[model samples]
Target chain A: MEIKTRQFKAVARQELNNPNSRIFLDLLPVVLSSLRQLAMASFPDPEAAQRLGGIIRAEALSRLPELLEQFEKNALKAGAKVFWAGDAHAANAYILELARNNQVDFVTKGKSMVTEEMGINEVLEKNGIEVYETDLGEFIAQLLKRPPFHIVGPAANVPPPEIRDIFIEKGIMENPTVDPRELGYAARLYLRDRFSRMKMGITGINFAVAETGTIINVENEGNIRFNKSSPKIQVSVMTLEKVIPNLKDAMHMLRLVSRNCTGQHIGAYASMDTGPRKKDEMDGPDELHIIILDNGRTRLYQNVKTRQALQCIRCGGCLNICPVFGIIGGFPYGWVYSGPMGQLLTPLLLGLSGCHDHIWACTGCGACKANCPAGIDHPRVLHYLREMEVQGEKSLDAVPPPFTEDMAYKAFSVIASNPTLWKLTSKIIRTVLNRNAQDGKLSKGPGPLETWLAGRDFPQMGDKTFHERWKEIENNPPKAVLEN
Target chain B: MKTVSLFVPCIVDLFLPDIGEAMARLLKRLGLSLVYHDAQTCCGQPAFHGGRNPEAVKLAKRFIEIFENDETIVCPSGSCVVMVKKHYPELLADDPAWLKRAQAVAERIFELSEFIVDIMGIADVGASFSGKVAYHESCQLSRELGVVEQPKTLIRAVNGTELVPLNGAAVCCGFGGHFSVTYADISEALVKEKAVHYIASKADLLVISEPGCFLNINGYLSRNHPEHKAMHIAEFLAGKQN
Candidate 1:
């Protein structure tokens, strides 16, 4: 992903106005939210499930350094080669070199956001290696040369006709078809050959248990299963914060992720690999390579307030319930992550320079916080980010807002503090506004009020302040006022 | 008799003083002695939520000083009540004594319907309105203040009123103080979506508890769908009773 997050206004305007995108984004969150609620009924204690999910992630992040070391030692002991990459550049380079060492010119990849974050597909293609995205959404997205629309269901909401055309253009379909099952079959057939011949399989680790040297990948389609075992070598790329304290916590997180994501009790397949196959095992990879990348995660871990960002399990629940995401979709986020999590991560990881747009885009409705199974306080973090941005602590690339916006807030603060000042200011503004009022409403507004009045009528200000009206009658002021 | 201090929000004081007057009339009818502090101004919510905490602190402290001695504080807008209850303590966290005072003041502050139903134990205030009425769940009231049922309970208590459930009623109306103008496109889309849902409900009038939503939703309705009517819950109940 190129960092066009700075162009959020233009991108969001386009997405908001596009009928196709609007229809899909509007319908997705409502459907996802309802499914999640219905699935939540199956839990003996759903609230406890939510709490435990958050606690486990918090525990993992608090002891991340120790847990990562423990996970590395145990994974190595279990016969997996573990490599640590400090950032996306190193992670991409390490994976490219590993492919060269394994004598592979092509690799099969499952649904891995880490790879996307690392820009691994572009890196491999540039270096003369064929990379095939096997997740049905990623596959279609790859064919279309577009980014995923939603985190869980990347190509899920894409129009069937467009996908049908893409499939026909790629020679996957003999004829154009809009049926999803037919399209799935076409993609499966096209991808099966690549799966068999690809010597290296790349995957994303959903959770790495520190108690045992185990890495788990949860998915509905079995692309991850084949991506891990159908090849001579497997490379799993994960961020360092994905580790959990134990297998018990990992199981709890799995249940939460499944229900919150697709409203399923469990994903169809959960591949938990301790390491490469032992001598007795059959149909497994000969070598297991786990790449744990810490791309700007440690900076978050060091900050007390922002460390909460690391607790995200990538369930995409926040995106499914977010009103903004429901309106404009994912591409406007301008990065691998989207929605509340995207708002937090983009500014933190990509730096505020190119990504403050989405961060500022949040309405602070707290819907994401309520929907998050991890109980991540996204609105609070967003407010903090906005405050930081306003303070100019980050993003030297960000241009300052017009003086009117800043001065308005500053002037409001002064007027809000003193009743005398507020009364005088309100009187002057109201008198002016009322003078211009037409038929009990200000049909046309001046300055910034134009934006508000453009869509809605501004009601005429009242003739008298509440205080003035209250004082007209002979009444005693509050006892509290006299006491003060 | 209950003694109450009325916290008149800046908007209510300026554009919609009738809401505050209606709230006062309702409180009086309930045998509550309401005191209006002439010195009371804004709740600092506009500045506080705008990321101007230092400036908000002056108003917040002034607010605490004005209402600290009252038995209870009632505000017509849930948006202001949320600012007082949730953010005041945070703004004053650096000063231990002020934080304690803010926490205390927060405890006694309530939105009108919450004070009426939860504190006064009066769901029915002897009001009547014969029509389909839909309630817009103001984000600060419903989500931030957790006063979801209080407003609906009061609305339903009005005789001859048929409460209609609105789709996406709990979603924001995009009156997020400065957000309406700052992010005009997104804010416009949200309010328009809210209006569409309200229109779909086929309600005769839309009722709301927070002034911000009352203004924002009604503003859109007046411009785009003038056939629709929206009013503050205080005005609705007070008008019927008086």
Candidate 2:
């Protein structure tokens, strides 16, 4: 939640050195990709599913204002209150006010990135209200006091030994146990009391149906279901783009969301909430509130190139497949979102200048684009962000050019246009680099080449240019080479 | 009777001329006459990826003017061919006249393996190599260009050559031009992971089509694991030393 994205280099270095994270990152993608491929095979046409997902999100975004109003009216009619927050500050203040007004001491929270984006836990704690993360991963992350490593499995990368120690320190376990089942039991025992005593609960809405004021939360664990149904006061928070036109569209999108998010045909729980308890109902929340937070999304929506980022279902598929995240994990992203989606959204939300560090980390491999169920072209969006940084757009003046990359590119273009000039430049660079070469390759380089030479060798340029060889080949062509 | 003009990438021109020479030899052996346009140098990918649109535009236009007339244009590098086929239209999108030329010239460009297998209809190339060879799928050729099968088919045709499968073959080797140098740690980390899988395959040679992957993988192999080797597909099929 805190903006430490500018420290990507340092964070990446730390992550790369941590062998624990590397082992987890390396194994997870292989397992997840296979699971996803298998789950996706069940669809008659996977591309069609992705296209439908993209189309539904695009339609929602095209008429966002109307859909939000429709959702508000329908929700109000269903006896649930709807509140609008323009940004993170307003979102945080409203939640804190709700807590204070009700004299609530402790609240249970389902996994919600929007809440993290608003820094609600810190705000609520500052106002003397305690918040408990009900999601298993989030609970572990809370115990460890670190940001979630992955979107779905936030503490999945964190080793069980470390978790055992955390549980022991937190007084939830009598002894350290490496077995994850024991840890789960420990967590369940600890959170069960909190669930029974908690007067208020909070959650994130995966999809909001506009036809009826219904919100859907899909999860493997049943924490969110309890967080919503067991508590008297319940609030579901979502960003503006989470709303869909109707239940049919919501169901259509859910098929891809579950499959893409964690490679599941269906999550164990799909808790759908319409409103509070009625006289006929046995048990439900007494109060239902939905907070739609903008927080820079409206600005992002105005830009055509960037609105594609909103289509993300937070599947974390891109993160699992991303080689960058495969090495560094999510901390370097410095926010709730990570991987391809984070690289695009972080800069848009945190301003390009400050968050431009991770934006440039993308290798333009297009793996994220290929894996995305939403059809978000992350490389294109990332390149657009880089271009914004290079051109020093009005919004990005605060982001100084990290290096003279533009100047080098300009020089490259000039040399590339004229073959004679290019020939001369290549010879000069090769000659200079050869002085440091050993065995036709420079094992250790000087100046800027040090980065490349840090681990791998730079192959020395050939003694003669291809042009020189081509001239000789032309003068004396190979005689009857092979069949010809 | 196909007349193929060779689009030698800037890196091939300077760093690895053997690849270009091998390509020329192989294409000639397949009975395709080759034309080398000396005016050609770079494909503007470095500038294009670096976000210098205006400068990349200049180089891209130069490429169009030089190669627009050639009916069949082939290059040893997948990255270069991708630049011409994919990004050129994007670069010159604002200029209709240039955009048309770029789009036209784009259809004419092909990577070496794809051209050999698809256009020339020659997968074997009447070549033989006796060893276990793992074909590293350069990102541009396999994922970006969708030429995944062409290279594999060619490799399988080589007599006595066992084509071993590579894990994460479609993943990047992290030789993203300036990316290797700018983000050296991440780049090195990636290439190291690549090397680990490559070694695990127990293949004597690692073959690739793109100049960048060739340079990066060979660079790592030559330094860390000197016994291992990586070669461009052109050089490997030509029975030439990589």
Whose lDDT is greatest here? 2
Off by over 4 Å in 1: A394-405, A473-484, B240-242
What local lDDT score does residue A468 receive in model 2, on the 0 to 100 scale?
75
Question: Mind giving the per-residue lDDT tens digits that candidate 2 earns over A1-484?
Answer: 5778788888989999988788778886688888888898899998788787888888888888899889999999999988999998998888888888998999999998888888999898888899899999999999888898888888887888999999999898897799989999999999999999989999999999887999999998899999999998998899999999999999888888888877898889998889888779988899998999999889898889888999888888899888878878988888888899999888888888778666788777888888887778898888778777778887644354756766677777888888889888977887788888888888666677898887788877778989879987655554333232
Model 2, stretches more than 4 Å misplaced?
A: A396-403, A444-446, A479-484
Model 2 has an lDDT value of 0.86
Q: What is the C-alpha lDDT of each candidate?
A: 0.85, 0.86
> Distance (Å) between predicted and true CA of A484, model 2?
19
True-structure RMSD for candidate 2: 1.9
Interface DockQ per candidate: 0.49, 0.60
Give each model a TM-score: 0.96, 0.97
What would the per-residue lDDT of candidate 1 be over residues A1-484, giving only the tens digit for each residue? 6667877888888888788787777776578788898887788988887887888888788899999999999999999999999999998999899888878999989998888899999999999999999999999888888887888888765788999988888788897789989999999988998987879999999999998989999999999999998889999999999999899999999999999999998999999999999999988799999999999888877888788998998999999887778878888887789889988987888777677576677666788887788879897887766666666664323344567878887888777767788888988888778877998899767777889988888888877889888965226432211110
Residue A12 local lDDT, model 2 = 88
How far does residue B211 in candidate 2 sit from its true spot (Å)?
0.8
